[model samples]
Target chain A: MTAVAGVAMANEPISPIAPVKEINLAQVELGKKLYFDPRLSKSGFISCNSCHNLSMGGTDNLKTSIGHNWQQGPINAPTVLNSSMNLAQFWDGRAADLKEQAGGPIANPGEMASTHTLAIDVIKSIPQYVVEFKQVFGDSEINIDRVTEAIAEFEKTLITPNSRFDQWLLGDKDAITATELEGYQLFKTSGCVACHNGPAVGGSSFQKMGVVEPYKATSPAEGLAAVTGKDADRFMFKVPTLRNVEMTYPYFHDGEAETLTEAVDIMGRLQLGKKFTDEENAKIVAFLKTLTGDQPSFLMPILPPSTDSTPRPQPFD
Target chain B: MTAVAGVAMANEPISPIAPVKEINLAQVELGKKLYFDPRLSKSGFISCNSCHNLSMGGTDNLKTSIGHNWQQGPINAPTVLNSSMNLAQFWDGRAADLKEQAGGPIANPGEMASTHTLAIDVIKSIPQYVVEFKQVFGDSEINIDRVTEAIAEFEKTLITPNSRFDQWLLGDKDAITATELEGYQLFKTSGCVACHNGPAVGGSSFQKMGVVEPYKATSPAEGLAAVTGKDADRFMFKVPTLRNVEMTYPYFHDGEAETLTEAVDIMGRLQLGKKFTDEENAKIVAFLKTLTGDQPSFLMPILPPSTDSTPRPQPFD
Candidate 1:
């Protein structure tokens, strides 16, 4: 298909990340409020945005997240941008979809540290939330499922479109520098595209972290093996998206790599079994930087106030 | 001044809050990004918005704030909306202005737990922040002064104006219900108007929490006494704004009162030595609800990504 630049297009492995054009605006609006409302957490301070912050490439930029009661998270937070493109959610592919993934943090003991019952009760108590829920769901029935569904819908709209790389793919040669173009070529020719080829440039499938070498990490997570109960699934993780990888740093599930250069070095050694020259690494890093795209822009949602009937947030308790 | 829905105008004791008409858009925009950027916190999880959230009446909606290491704050976090109207900042009036007040939480061990040095270092390390700071401040120099100044400036734009009560004060006869009008009259006849009269309906002066009678609260905070060495300042708090009191619930310095009616009851018994009937209290509560005004509406700022040179956040360390 011809792109906006009217340049001849070929069958490219990676597709352009498309901007969200149509959605249930009411549901999206409701979800935006829920996403920012910290009352969902037991501490009455942590919201979904606390970890997956839209301001910072939809990630907290933390090695491992600080959660309720200052509990350290087990794994690094994955960026929420273009996350809907993932075949399955989470590093281990435990959750089936975005909706299921959305529920994990709120209930997790180390995360939001809130019970589903308490969360539902909090929303139900707010008269304004009740009215909005009725308007969006066609009834005043507020439940965890509906809450997650709306949140997931809002997340789907967080796709970052029109990156410089996408422009280059659309037949504008000047979109990227010569070094970035060289990096792109090397990334493809070096066989890194096999697993990292998709609209999201990764997340299409689960892959072993260290194909050529045994990976050692301090985390106790067994990856997909914990979910599938298969010994072969150990150390297998859903490849994270490379889109906006420049911003979502401290890479990998363990968050051992602090910089892109270090991460690229480790990946070259462990995954590809190729020790690339420093120049080659720099070129690839330059290309990765081009993945930074247009972030979603929208008015901050004004949440409805809690009334006397609403269950008060137990921040201290 | 003539108001819409023309009615007889008079010199009201309280002036209607006016919307912000003039501002440095560039600085305001930069400040918006900084406000939402969590990287300023030591954990890189808490932001200024974490406590002064724009979504929920610019508060975390907890009786007391939750801070670093999950510490329970000593006092309630006041709403950021129309806070610029305060004669001075904080319950104790310790900070001379909003800019000074902005610096307190970031360094407070119980709050963000980030030092000014570290916060400045973090901002200075980010190349994009450097650029934005130069654009807004006419120099690349990044400091706590500029950071807090920009934040306070953006905060000035957070004034919520055009409440139904404000409309009523501007000669719109139908802006308020008859019961609400009666409630306002009672509020004046009682001594509440003495402390709560200004453009913001309060924040004009400091007053003792308990004037005629003793107030028993669990909080150990002595209000202005903590700021000043004088014992006479004990329990003297800067009267909080009544604007948007409906949304800023769990009223008072200690946040002991969970509802407006309860707050009114306590204020009457302690400050005025007069307990009102249930009907009178309900009318006051209804009138207070009319103070809910137009919340600030603005696009959520998308923060620039941290570069390789940027200092990594120490969430765990």
Candidate 2:
């Protein structure tokens, strides 16, 4: 399949960015509730928010994700931040859209390990969810697709657009400090913009992390080789968005870098074939901090009990 | 300390409900951001909403909770639906208050398992959270207590006090159906009111599921006995608030009942010391549906880059 370059190489001819349908407020509300609801998980303890916590970066700090059996996952958790802009999902780019990605974890036997049938059954059991889903998706049969659709609708609303960089992009020269401005210039001059410039900044491309110096393969860190198993694809992974780079830490796919500066410096040696002076690195870090944007906080529910027990899946085994 | 009764039970008589401090909108906003933030979890895959989901009764609906390690928990996942009113935290009544409970899951080896100190350190590392906390807690040392208090404040806003029953209590007689009215009478006459009736309904007390009869236990369905180890408490569990009962299902502590009728029959045989006639049971169930309230839905977040990544206690060894 041809790769879409809506945000990557300028010469690649940006394909028409897929128009995202506006999310209905009602659907978003239902989806938001679903996002926080734990009934989606097989074990009931895990929810989408448990790992994609709102307090920290959208990604957890662990090198590899832990799932239902406490079995360690094979790779680091990807940030849900600006994930909507990505053409494909996961490091291997397995799922085609966020909706498809939503279904993966629920039935992964780890993560949520929840089944589509079980998820719908759980929602249908809740008279409230049943009503909401019917209202949003219509009286159509409730299934994993609808569940994914509703959640995707809600997730689509998780847009972190319009950061200070966006403001600068909009010609708000004062939006960023002079140091940050210089850092931005350095970023471009240093060739960081070759792949890292876009609406989502970096999600638009996939690149080998160590282009100048080959990335050493670790027993566990298969990188792109794990996805394609192509010798040339070694140490390649999806380039992450740096929109809120300041907040995302322990940078890199393996979470090996404890700070963004370290990651930036490492990238200079590996990807850019250059070196960043300490001051340059410090200024870039400062500029990245400015990229942080305002986001909606977690909204708690005002749930009233069903007057009676309603039909639902059994909560326990 | 003497246990207070009703809403009065929450406050020390001398202190007046502990002088419930108003939550800072800024802090609450910050906490809300934190709530949806995924970096708090070890895998960056789950967030607070993962389990205490807003859509499906503020619970994931599993008998046992799933965690970072993807391990199954030993008890039913309780709703964060109206948890602020819970006198203590967890089914075992392990935590004394919300502040204490907030940190529990984050640090529990079976739950988030994020260390309190590490959680603080992580948040502190984020310049925005540091700024937000300073503004919210007013320089009152940014630590676990402040974090919990901020989150708890946000949680307090999650009040489910607008049910039709509440409206009826406030003099809206037409708010309920005739069957619901009859069920209300049966609810009181059948003695379910002895424990399940109150402003928060059922949450005010702890009771045994099978009072007049002994019921066989299911897998991981030990009930409160697991906490207290008292013979009388073996089948006893927290009297869950039936406020959002219809939305929260897999009835009872173990979530064994899939339908309300089954739950009603079980409750009748065990707790009420009699069989529920089909008509009576139907009326009771009808009344339960009336307890369902109109909860506003959430606006989906437009996908944004999340910014938290501090070391949290790893759930898996």
Best prediction by DockQ: 1
Stretches of candidate 1 exceeding 4 Å from the true structure: A1-9, B1-10
CAPRI-style grade of the A/B interface in model 1:
high
> In model 2, how large is the Cα lDDT of residue A31?
71
Regions of model 2 farther than 4 Å from truth:
A1-41, A44-57, A95-103, A106-156, A219-230, A296-317, B1-50, B84-89, B92-96, B103-107, B114-130, B143-145, B218-237, B294-315
User: Tens digit of lDDT per residue, candidate 1, span A1-317?
Assistant: 35644443255667678767768889998999989888888877788998999888999888888888888988989999999999999999999999999999998878998988999999998888899999999987999999999999999999988999998887777999999989988998888888887789999999998999778888987899999999999999999999999999889998889899999888888999989899999999999999988988898888888888877777666
Q: What is the lDDT of residue B270 in candidate 2?
A: 90
- Candidate 2 local distance difference test against the native: 0.66
lDDT of 1 by residue, B190-216 (tens): 878899988888998999998999888
Tell me the TM-score of each prediction against the true structure: 0.97, 0.79
Model 2 agreement with the true structure over B114-189: per-residue lDDT tens digits? 6677677777766667777778767836887888887776666556655776555545668778888898788878
DockQ each: 0.84, 0.28
For candidate 2 chain B, which ten residues in a row score worst on lDDT? B11-20
